[model samples]
Target chain A: MGRAILLDKVNIPGIRAFEVYREHGGYKPAGKALLGMTPAQVQQEVIKSGLRGRGGAGFPTGLKWSFLDRKSDKPRYLVCNADESEPGTFKDRYLMEKLPHLLIEGLILSSYALGVKTCYIYIRGEFKYLVGILETAIHEAKKNNYLGEKILGTDFSLEIYVHPGAGAYICGEETALLESLEGKRGNPRIKPPFPAYKGLYDCPTVVNNVETLATVTSIISMGGDAYSKLGIGKSTGTKLMSACGNINKPGVYEIEMGLPVEDFIYSEEYCGGIKNDRMLKAVIPGGSSVPILPADLILNTAKGQPRLLTYESLAEGEFISGSMLGSGGFIVFDENACIVRNTWNLTRFYRHESCGQCSPCREGTGWMEKILYRIEHGQGRMSDIDLLVRIAKNIEGNTICPLGDAAAWPVASAIRHFRKEFEEHIK
Target chain B: MLKVTIDNILIEVEEGTTILQAARMIGGKVVPPAMCYYTSLKGSGGKCRSCLVKVAKGSAKDPRPIPKLVASCSTPVQDGMVVENTISAEVQEARKGVVEFLLINHPLDCPVCDQAGECDLQDLSYGFGMEETNTREPRREYPVVDIGPLIKLHMNRCIHCYRCVLAAEQLTKKRAHGMLYRGDTIEISTFIRTAIDSDFSGNMIDVCPVGALTDRSFRFKSRVWFLNPMDAHRECSHCSGKVAAWMFGNEIYRITGRKDTFGELEEFICNECRFEKKDISDWVIEGPRKIKRQSVISGNHYEQMKKGSIIHPIEGTTEPQE
Candidate 1:
C-alpha cells in the first residue's frame, strides 16, 4: 500500500506509462549511465551501496555483478529468476503482476551495466498468465525504444525474452533454472561451475533473482546511498514481506528491513495484528523452509535481546533454534491452526518438490512427509516424533541443492518448536 | 585424508567426506545403512533410513548409549571420529517402522517383476522388516496409473521411493514426475495426466526398489532373477546418458538407470533418449527384396503363393507379387 521504489506510482491513473515514468525522473539513470558513466563505474557505485539480493538468499547484488567472468570473449548474458514458486513467497508475483514496467526498466539498466545483450526472465509455470502480461510490457517497452536494440540512441543493444517453466519448483534454484533455460531438465547443477562462472549454454552469465533486478532500478535512480539509509547495517532497504496466514491483512507489504517483529505482528500500521486477537502460536519469519519459532522465542533473541526484523537480528540463534529469513515467505500460526497439520503441509511440499536427484532428499522427504501425515492424521505412535527428527537430520546437508535443506529445516524446526502440539495430535 | 573409525575398525577418507562416503571408500569399513544415498546427491536424499550407526561419546562407564544407529548416508567423516553399527533395539524398531511404512502400498509381486533379482526392499527387509505386518488388515492397493507412453505403472508394487522421478528430472533437466500427495495419502503423479512422457521414462523402472513401477514393454516377459545384466553403456535411442538394459533369453527386456558422467539418470537423460527407447527396443529389420527371385518353395498353388508373398514385384517398394 505504501511507496517503495518499485511500487512508487503503481496505482496511479496515468503512471503506468513510459511517459509518466519518464516524467517522474525514471530511466534517467540508464540515460545517465549510457550518456555519461561507464559500466565499470556503475558497478562500482552498486558495490559501494552494499545492496543485497532481494531474492531468498540475500546475496550481495554488486558482488554478484562483480563475479561475471569478464575474461571471456563470448557474449555475457543475464537471467532473471522469476520462478518465485516458494510456497509462502509472493512478492515478485505482485510486483510483476502489478508494475511490470519497473522490472523491465531495471532489467534494461542491469543489462547495460553487465554488458548483457540478451536477458531472459525464467518464470515458474504457475505464472503462465503473468507471462503474457510481461510479454505485453516487453512489447510496450520495445515500442518506446527502451527494450530492443540501442535504448535512447545508445550504441548498446538488448533483447528480453520470457521463458515459462513447466511447473518444477527446483527451477527456482539458480543453477537448476539455468539448466532449464538451456532446454534441459530443471535439476540443480553442481557448484564451482556456478552460473556466475559458467552458465546458460555454458557461457559467462549472471542470474539475478526477479526482485533483485527490480531493486536495481531504484538503486540507479535514488542513488544507492539513499536506498541504503532505509534499513539497518548491511540489511539496508525496504524488503517486500509476504505476510499470510492468521494476520488480518494477508498479503505482500513493503516494510523497512529493521522493523520490530512485535510491532509487525501487533501494530495497526502493519499486518493489523493477528486474527481475532488470538495468541500467536508461532511465526515462520522468513519463508516456509526456515525454522518455525515459538512466539516467545520469536519475540526475544537468543541473548534475550529485542528481536528486530533485520536479517542479523532475525537470524540470531539459528540452527535448530531460530527461524530463517529465506525468500520472505512469512507464515503465521494462530491458536486455531494445527501445528502438526501445518508442518505436514510444509513437509508435504518438500517431499513433493524433492527432485530425488540424491538418495537422501529423494527418499527422505517422501518418507518424512508420510510420517508427518500419519502423525497429523492420528495414526502416529509415540516414537514417530523422534523418527521425524532423525529423518530430518539425515536430509539437512545431504543434497544437490538447498531444496533438500529447505525441506528438512521446516520439519526439524516444527518438531523442535511444537513437540507438545505434535504429541497432542498423536493418537 | 581424515582418519576415522567404525566400531574398532580404522579407516581414512578425504576431507569434506560424509561418514557414508567414507564407509563407501573402504569396503566393510563401517556399514551405515544407506537406503537412498550416494556422494553425488550433494549428500542429501536420506530416504532409506537403514544406515544407522552409533558414534563414540566421551565416557568409559557408559561409552555407548542405548541407541547404536545413525544414518551413515549423510553424516560426513571427521578426524578421530568413531562409530558403531551394532543393531540396537531402538534402531531395529525405527528400521522396522520405516520398512513397514514404505511397504504399505508396495505390491510385493516380486515373482512377476523385472527388478526382483536386484531389489533393495527384498534385500533390506530381512534386516529391517520384523516379519510381522504393522497393519492387521489386508494390505492396501494403490490404483495403477499410466504415467507415460513408454513407462508402465504398477503403483501397487511401488514403495513410493522417488529414485526414478529424480533420475528423469536430473537427466532430462525437465521435471516429468513428482510426488503429488502428502503423508500416507501421498501418491506420485504428474501435475496433469496429459503427458508425463519423457525420454527418461525407462529409468523410473530402473531406480524403483520394488515392483511398484514395472516396464510395460517387458511387463509379462520374465522375472528379474532370470535376466543376466551386462554393463555396456548402450547409446540411448535418443540422447546420451547411456541406458543399461537387461537381457533375458537374448532379448533386451528391461532398461534401468546406471551411474553416468552427467547427473542422476532421472534428471540427466536427454528428452530424446528418454522417449525414444520403446521404439528402439521394438525395432525390426526389413529383409532385402528380390523382384526376379523368390523363395525355394517350388510347389503348386499354395506353395507358389507363399513364395510369391515372400518376394516383392516392385524392386524398391513393398508390394504384393503379381
Candidate 2:
C-alpha cells in the first residue's frame, strides 16, 4: 500500500516551512495548477479522477464542487470542517497537528478550483492547541506568500480564517459548521438550500472535511487518473483511517480503498493482529456510525466473499450491515469487548450530541439510551432488549438531518448484528 | 388531483401527499399517529413509530400488503396505495405497543410537569397505552437543571423527541441542544452544562415533545387546558416579525414561532419576544375613546405633548430622563 501522501512526510525532516516544503516539491501542485491550468480544468481533472469525499459520505468531490450555486452573485466561501468530533475518528486531528500545511495547501488549491477568495477553517473548539498550530502555519504561509493576498504572481487572492467551534458535535455537519462560522448556534440549517447554495451569511459556500480537501492537492499534482489509480472501483483513491482499539498500532493509518477488513486488522503491518491475539468479535468498518460486523461477517460477505473495505463492499446490505462510511471512525473490539455495552456507549454519545433537533431523535435517542443503560447496568429484561431495538428503529431516517440516523445506526445495527450479546446482558 | 380511499372513505387531495397529510385534508383524525409531524412544517418528520399505517400492495381498491405499515410522516402517498390506518386489530396493537414502549421509561411525573395538560405523550398514553408495569425500577433520574438562563429542564420528563434540539439547530438558528449519551444510557445535555443561555433558548421549552424540556417562565404556572388559547397574531414591537403569543388569564405568558402563515420559515421567537409580553411597563388608558400624547423621552417632553391636549396627559415614569 502507498504511504499516506500528506502524512508520509508529516514527521519527516524538511516538511515544515515553504523553504523546506518547496525544496522538496511542496507547492509544485499548486504552482503547476495555478500556472498551467484553469480552475474549471482543475475541477474537471478531479471529477475525471473519480475521487470521492473521505469524510465518510463517499460523495464525489468533483460533483460536490460542481454542485456549487455558480450563478449566485454572493461571495463563495470554502469552509474546511476541522471539527473531528466523531468518536474513534481522530485522523483529522493528526493532519492538523502534523501536516497543517498539507491541509492549507489543499484548501488553497480547492478554493482556487471553486474560485473562492475567502475560506474559513472551522476548527473544533476543543482543539485549543490545534487552533494555534493552524494559526502559526497560516502566519508562516502568509509570510511566505502561500495564503494571503496573491501567490507567485497568480491572478487569484484568498484569505483563510480559523473559526473554532463552541464544542458542539453537530457542528461537524457541513451546514451546522456554516451556522457556527456565521456566529450562529452550531445547529444544521435545512437542506435544498444545502451549504453549496446559501451558507455562511447566505453566500455560496462549499464545506469539505480536512481529509477530503487535502486529497485535492495530490489529485492536482498527479492528475486525476494517477490519483484515482491508488484505489479500486467507484470508491477510488486512498483513505486515511484512524484504526484504533485492540490494534497493535492504534494510530492513524492510510490505506488504499478495497483492502480486505481482515488484512487491515490482522496484518502484522497494519493493526498488527488484534491485541493479545484474541479473536476479532466485530469491526465498525466506517466509524461508530457504521454497523459492526462479526468476525465471520467481517471476513466474508453475505455472498460468501471476503468483506473488502471499500464504501460499497462494507455497506452493501443496508442498515448498519450496510451503512454510510460515516466519518471513517473505525473502532475495533476483540472477542471480550461487549458489543452491547460499546453500542450503549455510542448511543449515549448520539443521545448526548443529538442536538435535540427533531422529535424522534431527541426523544428516541434518549429513550434508547435509557433502556440500554438499564440493560447494561444488569437490570435488563427480555422485553427491554426488544424495546431498545424498537425505539432505535422508530428514530431511523426521520429527522431534520442525518443525526437521527447517526443516533439510530448503532442501536439498530447492534441488535441486528449482535442480538446475542444483548440477550446475554439481560439478567 | 390524485384520489385514494382511506378506511373505505373516499377522499380527494393533491397528488404527492402522505396518507397522514391526505387524511388531514378531510378535516378529521387519521388513525395513525405522528410525533415528528409539525403539520405546519408540511407534516413530514417521521422519526416516531406512532404514525405507522399499513398500506396495500397495489390499487386502492384491493388491500393485501401484509405488514406494510409505514410511518405516515415520511411515507409519501401514492395514487393507488391503499391505507388501512384503523381497519385491522394489528394496526391498533402496533400503536399500543409503541405507546407502551414510549411510556415504560417515561417518568410518571406529569403531576408536577408544566406541560401536563397538553403533552402528546400524555394524550397518546390515554388513547393507546397497554403496558401495566409492576417493575419497581426507579424512573430515569436527572437533576432539575437550568439548561439555558431561560430554559428549565426536568430531563426526567424528556421523551427525547429531539423537537427542541431540532428547533434549536434548525429553527432557532442556533445549535443550543443535543443528546449527551448513547443508547438507553443516553440523555440530552448541553455537553458541559445544562444552561442554554442563547437569546433563542426559550424556544426549546416549547419544542420539547414532553415535559422533559420545560419552560422556567411557565413552569407550574397553570394547566394548559386551564389557559384559554386565543388565536391572535401580534406584531413584534422589537422587529417586523409577528409572534404567536399565548395569553393566560388576560396576560401573555409565552409567544412562539407562528407557522400559521403563508410562505414563511418557522422563525424562532427570541427571549425578547417570549418574555417581553409580561414586561409591559405602560398601557394606553382609554375613556370610551380619546386621543392623547404623552412622551417621557425627556423630563419635559410629557408636558410638551400635553400642552396642546384638551385633557391633561397622564404618563407614568419608571425612569427619569435628564
Candidate 3:
C-alpha cells in the first residue's frame, strides 16, 4: 500500500516474460547504469542513498561494496544470495518466481557498479521450480542484450550464472554460500579475512542478498536521493517482508520503511489481524533465528513507543525486551500458540541445518533441541530451564559462524519472555 | 613480533600466532584446553568452542575488541592485545557449558573405552565440566562401524571435532570418511562399506579425542597406562619412521606416532608402522632411562620410572630375561 517498489508490477500477467517485463520498464536502470553513469558514480549514489542490506545483518550496502580489496589484481565477483531458507521468510522466492527481471536488472546494475566481470545468483536448492523461471529470464535478458557481452553499446561486459545450492540453510550465510559455490560442503569460514578481502575461490567477492540486489534497481531508477528520502534514518528505502503465521493473509508484502507494526499486523490492508480474530500472543518480527517478542513488546518498545518496521526501531532495546527486523520475516502468533513448542520446532530446524563444522553449533543445537523437546512434552525438570539458558549462552558467540547465535537467540528469548509457558510444559 | 597478555602474563610471539599457541608457549595453567585444534595439522581448529577467551583490548591492526568471546585457536595475536582465559569466570563457565554439551550424548563409556587413559575429552571434562547434567532425555547412540580390518569406529563416542576427518583428508589424502545425515543425527560415515584402506589410516585412531575411532590391532590389548611407551624409529620408504612402541612386559602390543611433550605427534606415521610393525625387532629401541622425562604418560609414572620400579634386564626390553 505504501509505494511498492519491488512488487509493483508483480501482479501483471506474463511479467515473467522478457517482452512484457521490458515494456513495464524492467531494464532501464541497467542501461542508465551501463551507458550513462560511471561505476564509481553508481557506487557513490548507492552510498549516498543510505541503503542498508535487506539481508538479516542489515549491513550498509555501499560500505560493503567499498570494502572490496580493489587494490588487489584479482578479478572481482558479485554473488546474489538467493538462498532464502530462513523459516518464515519467502519474499526472495516470490521476487524470483514472479518478477525475475527485476532481480536480473538489479544484478546487472550492481555488477556494473562493482566492476565485476562474473556474477552468480546462488539460489536455494529447494527452489528448483524458481530456478527454471530465473534461467529463462536470464536467457531472455541475454537475447535482448540486457545481459552478456557489450551491453548497451558500452565497453562493460557482464555474465550472470545461476548456481543452485544442494538444500542447505547455512548456505544463506555469505561465507558458507561461497564455500558451496566452490563445490565444497556448506561450512562457514573464519573471519578477519572477510568475503570483501578474500572470497569466492579466494578472489575478492561482494555477496548481496536477493532483495538487496533487487532494491538497487529502485535506487538507480528513482535516483538515490529520492529513494533515500523514502524511509526512516539509516533504514532507508522500501523493504520486502515475508508476512506469515496466524494471520488472515500470509504472503510477501513490499512496504516502505517506517511502517507501524500495529497497522502491518491488524490493519485490513496488510495481515488483517490474527486468524479467527483471536488475541495475539507473540510475534517473531524477523526470521526464526531472531529473538521472539511477546505481543506488547512487538507492538511497542520497552519505552512504550510504537514499534516501526525499521531496523533501528525494532532493535531499540537490544535482545532483552526487543528483537531484530531480520530478513523482514514477520511471523505473528495468536493467543493459542505455544511458545515452548514453537521454540522447540525452531531449535529442531537449526539442529538439522547445522553444517556440523563447529562443535558448539553441532553439539549444542542438538542438546538444546533435546532439552526443549523434553520440556515441550511434559518430561522436563525445572533445572532444565537454567540448563537451556546456559547452553544457549555458551553457543551465542563461541562459534565459527553466526549459526550458533542464530540457534541460540530464539531459545534464550523464548525463555526470557515466556518462562511461564516453559514452566507449564514441565511435569 | 606481537605482544599479548594471557592471564596477565606478558609474552611476545611472532605475528599470526594464535592465542592458544601463545598460551601453550607460556606453558602454565593458562593453556586453554583445545579439544579440536591439532597444532600439527593446518586448518584444524575453529570447530570446537572450548578455547574461547576474552580480549579486553584488541590488537593494533584492529583496535576494537571483536564484541564476542573469540576462539583462541583461530584468532591471531595482535600487537598489545589483552586476552583472558582461565582468569575470567565467564570464560570458565562458557567452557564448562561446552564440555557439558559434549558429554550430554557422549555415552560416558570411559570405563570400557580404549582411549580413556589419554582421551582429550576426558581430561577436558574433568577440568571444565559440571558435576552432573540436567537432561533426563536419552543420549544418542550410533551403530558401531568397522570401516576395515584395521580400525573399529564407535560413532556414538564421536564429538564431531572433525579431527579424524581432517586426518583422513590431510594425512591420507583419501578423504574416505565424511559426516553424513545432519544436526544431532549427524554421524561420520563412508560412502559404501569400503575399507578406509590408506597409507596413514591409523592416524585417525591417534587423532581421535574420544574413543570413537579405536585401533582394531590394539583393541582390548591392554590399558595404555600399563604399557611402557618407548621411543623408536625405522628407516622406511613411506614416511618419517619415528614412532612409539607401547610395550606390555617384553612384547610390544602396538605402535603409534610418537608425540612431543605437548602431545602433538612428532610425525604422522604410515599404516605400516601403526598396524604392521608390532614386534620389538622392528626398530632399535631407545633406552627408557634416556627417554625424556616428559615422555611418560603422567607424573605418577614419571616418579615410578625415575625410582627404577620396573628395571629393564635387557637393553630394549622392560621384562627380566630368563
Candidate 4:
C-alpha cells in the first residue's frame, strides 16, 4: 500500500546472489558513497535525513554517528546489530534470509561513512542458518569488489565478519552484543562512556541495527532530503513491521512512517483485520518491551486523535494510554485471548532473558514470573495484584540496563489495561 | 568539585565521583547500601539495584535526571546535583522490594551459615527488608558444589552479585567458575570438575555478599563473634602480606584480607595469606584492642561487643615470634 523501499526487490528471484543484486541497483549507492561523497558529507546527509534508529530506541542514526570520538587514533569499528531476538520480531531475519546482499551493501556503505576498517554483523545464535547465508553473501560481495579491501576501486577498505552469539537473548542489546563479540559474557556496560566514545576493543564504534543500516542504501540512492520527505515529521522513510498473532496476513510489511493504525490492521493489504471476524482485545504495537495497548487505545489516542504508526503518534500518551513503535514488531490479540496468560508468557520470556546482572531485573523478573504464574494458575490472593504492581514499579528504571524496564512495562501495562481480567483470574 | 545535596546535606566531591562514594564521604544517615559494588574492582557497579537513589537535580554535564531511579554506585555526581537516599519514600520502598526479591530464593539458613556475622546480605536485609515474605511459592533450591579444597559454593544463597567472578578475572586473571544457567534458575558452577586453584581463589569468600561461597578451612571451626581478630602482616614473595588473623583464644584459626571501616578489603590477600598462613607464628599479630566494631552476628551479640566482652591475649604471649 505504501512506497516499498526494503521489500521492493526482496521477492525477486536470485536477490540473495551478488550478481543479480548488483544488476538490480544493489551496490550502486555504496559505490556512489565511496567514490563521490566525503565521509563527513555522507554523515551530514544522514543527519539531514532524520532517520531514527529502527532498533527499538528510535535514536537518530546521524546523531549517534556524530558522537564517535574522531580525534582518537584508535581504529574505529562498525557493528551491524543482527541479533534480532526480540519476541514477535523477525523482520531482520527475513531481510537477511531473502535480501542478504542489500544488508551487505548497506554494511559496506555504513563502514565507509564511519571511517571503519573492520565491521562485524553480530547475529543472534538461533539464526545459525542465516550465518551461513550471510557468510556466503559476504564472500560473493567480496568477489564482486562490493566488499573487502579497496572496495569499488576506492581507497576505503573494509572487512566485514559474521560473529554468532551463543543463543542469549540479552546479546540483542548493543553493549551486551559488543561484550559477546569480544568473546566474553554478554553483560551490558554502563553509559557516559557510551559505545561511540569507547566500544569494541576500547575504540570508537557505531552499532546500527540491521534495518537501520540497510536503509542507508536508500538514503544514499535517493538523496537524504528526498528520503526524509517520504515519511511524516521526525519519523522519516519506510519501516519494516513484523506482524503476528490472530492476523490473516502475518508477516513482515514495509510501509511509509505515518500509516494509520486502523488501515494497517483492518485493511486487506496489511494484517487483513482480526481472524474469523473476532473483536480485537489488545495489541502490542511494538516489541514485548513496550507497553501493551487496549484495542481502543491502539486505534486512537486519549486526545481523540487517530494513532499513526510513526514513533511520535504511537507514543502520544506515553505509558499512561500510549505504547511505542519499538522494533516495529506488531502483535495482535483477539477477544478470546487472555491478558493474564499473555502477560505471563512475556514475563517468563523476560525472566529467562535477564542476564542476572541488575537486582531489579534479575530478581524482580523471576518474582514477577512466579507471581504471574501463580495468579494464572488460580492460586493467587487478591493482594498479589497490588504486590505485582509494586514489584514492577520497583523494577522499572532501577537497573543497569533497560532490561529492568523491559521486564516491568508489559506487566504494568497489562495490569493497567486489563485489571478486570487479572481480578477475575484471582477469583 | 561538584556540590551535591544528599538528604538536605550539602557536600562537595571531586568530579566523576559516584553518589555512593559521595554518601560514604559525607558519612551520616544517608549511606546507601550496595551489594555488588566493590570499590577496588573496576566495572563492579551497576549490577546490584540495591543502591537506587533519587536525583532531584542532575549535574551540569548531564542536565536531566535519568527518567527512573538510578543506581547510586554507578551514577556520577554532577555539579549542582541533588540526590535523595533514605529521605525518599519511593527509594526506600524500592530498596525494600529489592531486598524482598533477593530473599525470595535465599535458603535463609543463616543459623547454619558460617558467614552469618559478616554477611552483607544479612545486614542489608535487616536494614531495608520487611518483616514477612508475601510469596507462598516454593523457593529455589540448588545442590552445593565444593569448588575445591579452598571454597564451598552454596549457590542457592547467592544473590548473583558477580563479585567473585570479577575477583577471579580481575584479580587472578583466570576463571574457574562462572554463571552456568540463565534467569531464575541461574547458578555459578565450574566448567568441569577442576578445582579453582588460583592463588586468589580464597578471596571469593571475602567478595561474596551472601553465604554462597564459604572458606572450607574455617567451616564450623568457630563462630565469628567468638573469634578475636587482629591486624597482621608478613614479608611474603607472593603479594602484600597484610591480613586479619581471627584467633580462637590463643590459637589462630583463619586469616583474611584486612578491611577498612567501610568494609572494603585493604588488599586482596592471596590464598597463601588466606589459607596457608593460619598459624599464629606466620606473622606478628597486633593487640585485640584494635578490634573496635564487629559485623552484626545475632540479636544480642552487638550489645555484647559494645560492652567489650572480647578476650585479650594474656600479657607477653601477644608477641608470637616464629
lDDT per residue for candidate 1 within B1-322, as digits (tens), equals 7777766667877777766666666654245555555343342344555565555632234444423344566555667777655534454555555565556446566666666655667767765665654332345456667777666776656555456666666656577777665334456777775456654456566556666666666767876544433333434445544544444433555555553221233333444433344333342212211111221111212122322232232352233435
Steric clash pairs (candidate 3): none
CAPRI accuracy category, model 3: medium
Tens-digit lDDT string for candidate 3 (A290-322) = 999999999999999999999999999998899
| Candidate models: Cα lDDT each | 0.69, 0.70, 0.87, 0.86
TM-score of each: 0.68, 0.71, 0.96, 0.94
In model 2, state the lDDT of residue A306. 81
> In model 4 chain A, where is the ten-residue run with the lowest total lDDT?
A355-364
RMSD of 1: 13.3
The segments of candidate 3 whose C-alpha lies over 4 angstroms from its true place after superposition are B289-296, B304-310, B313-322
What TM-score does candidate 2 get on C-alpha atoms? Answer: 0.71
Clashes of each: 47, 51, 0, 0
Arranged by TM-score with the best first, the candidates are: 3, 4, 2, 1
Task: Report fnat in order of the candidates.
Answer: 0.04, 0.10, 0.75, 0.76
Decoy 4 TM-score against native:
0.94
Runs in model 1 deviating more than 4 A are A1-3, A190-192, B1-322
Q: Residue-wise lDDT of candidate 4 within A141-169, one digit each (tens)?
A: 88888777887788888899999998888
Which numbered prediction scores highest in DockQ against the true structure? 4
